[model samples]
Target: MEDPVNAMLCHHGFHPSMLAWCSMHQLNLGIMQDFSGSAILLLVRISFFGNYNAEDHLRESMKECTRRFKDFCKLHSFECSQCWLTTGMLHDNQTGWPSLKLKAYNARIFLMFVRAALQAAKSAREAQGLEEDAELSYAVMAAKALCSWFALVERAGRYLTPEQAAEQETAGLVFLRCYTFLARLAASQSIRRWHVITKFHGFRHILQSARLTLYNSRFLHTYVDEDFVGVWIRLSRRVAHALFEFRVLCRFLLRLQAMRTVDQRSVPARWS
Candidate 1:
């Protein structure tokens, strides 16, 4: 290695393998792409003599699933109410990844994705004269793999049993193989938006990180920091620019103190 390169900070100078990734982000990206990627869309397209469209069938099924979950969320909003789920599960591919990740945190989301895929496959089977629908089968398999991975994620935040660690490794491997096949299918079909990228490789690293600890610990992701940034963005937009940084700090601190005061259990202070 050259001296100049060695002198750089650890993060900027490190090998690709040395860099860590956000597990939550990677999982959500892959899951989101599976349902909405052009490859999957092409695979879901039905070419039949009649008016039945498999893609439309799948879409409606997903919407129905989302509606059911939305109803459940109304009664228990704190546990599962996410903006994307409340509106509809089909988020725009352009700028909706954050909202998609928030939806992914809700476990009922798996039912919608997997249910729609399975229903589409079943419809293809019931179509009278069609041969084996390999593409639909591929979508079904990928969706199920995603469902399996999501279930694994929902098991526990930290300190998994040895059995659970083994399951995580197996789920990661199956998820990779399913998506690699879909990428190859995309190649054969000349689909434009479904090529594999390095970000997907982080899932294995996530599996490693998930099993690395020996005991209970806080979650690896810094969601609180993300929440703080979101709050600041809203605050900055609404406030005047003068003393911007100081105002933000003071207001943030005040908000925190007020929250604590409102929630505290001590008797209210009285002035005699």
Candidate 2:
């Protein structure tokens, strides 16, 4: 079975079609019986399929799948309320269900982030001749999405024992990638809003939190490749440079203000 699956994946060039087929097969076989488990698998399929192809059609498909999955979960909750054994109870008997749920939640949040990013890019393009407020609104939306993602990651961390989580290098790498993504987004936003003092503070906070996430997962260095580490290093440098420039600007402003005050003090009394 593994050979056939691998062969099919290779034959299909690891395309969305292969993922769709596997998803449908799982559904038909009742392998993913629980709504939450099924939803998680669906999210994974969509993520894997859409990752390499970021077309509008792919985005729309992902959105539709997510909407349907959410509806399914809602309906499942209502049905479970009438049943003796709830989905929560069922999951309690399954040792790895919590981890699966967390991964699904992360995937859902990432989908939201992708949608927000697309919206922001579209707004930026359309706002070329529009008011700055329009662009700012999109920026705020993106920032809120990032905040939600960070919160979800924190929440997911609480689901597992610290020792068990530390052993999950793959999951740690996922978290690292997410942190890097958030850091890059914040750095870009900071560069655009350099004059906004509050944004620089936010950027610093994002960088610090990302660094902490990576530091906690530093043990993953042996598992990941050099390129992965290099990417983190490059992103860190970019963020650091942005922070450095922001600080320099602040100092320049302070110096200019001081010089203006000195010039005012040195001026002769008003010609009365």
Candidate 3:
């Protein structure tokens, strides 16, 4: 294969739509790009002779990439962190990815974010002039949802049977990942009134579109055998849940906006 960096850049092509696609698919484009860069360097480190030196460097580099990716996600919002698991961050040495350990670490961060967001929301609500509680609440929900996702993934990893392990390594663990992302996003959106933001309309819409694409994709129909009925069902369920949550969020936002309009209009025209 080509250098990981080159491979990622080639695959993703530096486009916003590509980024959206990554998000829709629950891929971590930024972290994936980072690890692809690190993977190339890992190959170089492997060429050296000292076993300890190479291993040390590889571990450090891997952890560094993960830390940077996590930090980036925090900077942008936890939504992107949820994307990292399906993205490039998953490409590390299967035995050495430190997934359970990472999950524990992220869980702590997630709780911290939850507390901070709640505090901020309380402050905003008390301040009266600032209407930022919606956004803060969303951030908290995103962090909590991410923590829940990591817990699920860690559980899946810890409890995997031999057959499931083989399946994970092969066609990839699509159900767990896609489901986690959709569920997390839905939960966060519900908490944050994120659906109130017009720009985010496409977010839920894309998941709906992806469900149709995957269900009808020639690649799936051609490749997935009847024997894989279980996998098919799981994927279908994930898609359905995602779409259902999206609809609920849309309705909730519509009602909220309508109420806001009514409240604003109820006031008398004359000054108090």
Best by lDDT: 1
Please provide, for model 2 over 116-193, each residue's C-alpha lDDT reduced to its tens digit, 9 standing for 90 to 100: 444544465456755443333333343444444334334432133344334343333343344344335536765212
In Å, residue 235's CA in model 2 sits off its true spot by 43
Deviation from native of the Cα of residue 164 in model 2, angstroms: 25
Best-to-worst ranking by lDDT: 1, 3, 2
Task: List the RMSD of every prediction in angstroms.
Answer: 9.7, 25.9, 22.5
lDDT of 2 at 176: 37
Candidate 3 per-residue lDDT over residues 30-58, each given as its tens digit: 22222223222322233221234643655
Clashes of 1: 0
Where model 2 places Cα greater than 4 Å from the true spot, the runs are 1-121, 124-128, 134-214, 217-272
TM-score, each model? 0.56, 0.19, 0.21
Backbone clashes in model 3, listed as residue pairs = 28-87, 32-88
Per-residue lDDT over 1-272 for candidate 1, one digit per residue giving the tens place of the 0 to 100 score? 75574443556556754445665566654545444443223433452212345556545544444554466556445355444332233444564421222443553454444445455655767676667666556656666666676677665445566677667667767767876776787679775534565667677677666566321112455545577898888888877799999998888888767755342333323311
Against the reference, the lDDT scores of all candidates come to 0.54, 0.36, 0.37
Residue 131 of model 3, lDDT score: 54
TM-score (C-alpha, index-matched) for candidate 2: 0.19
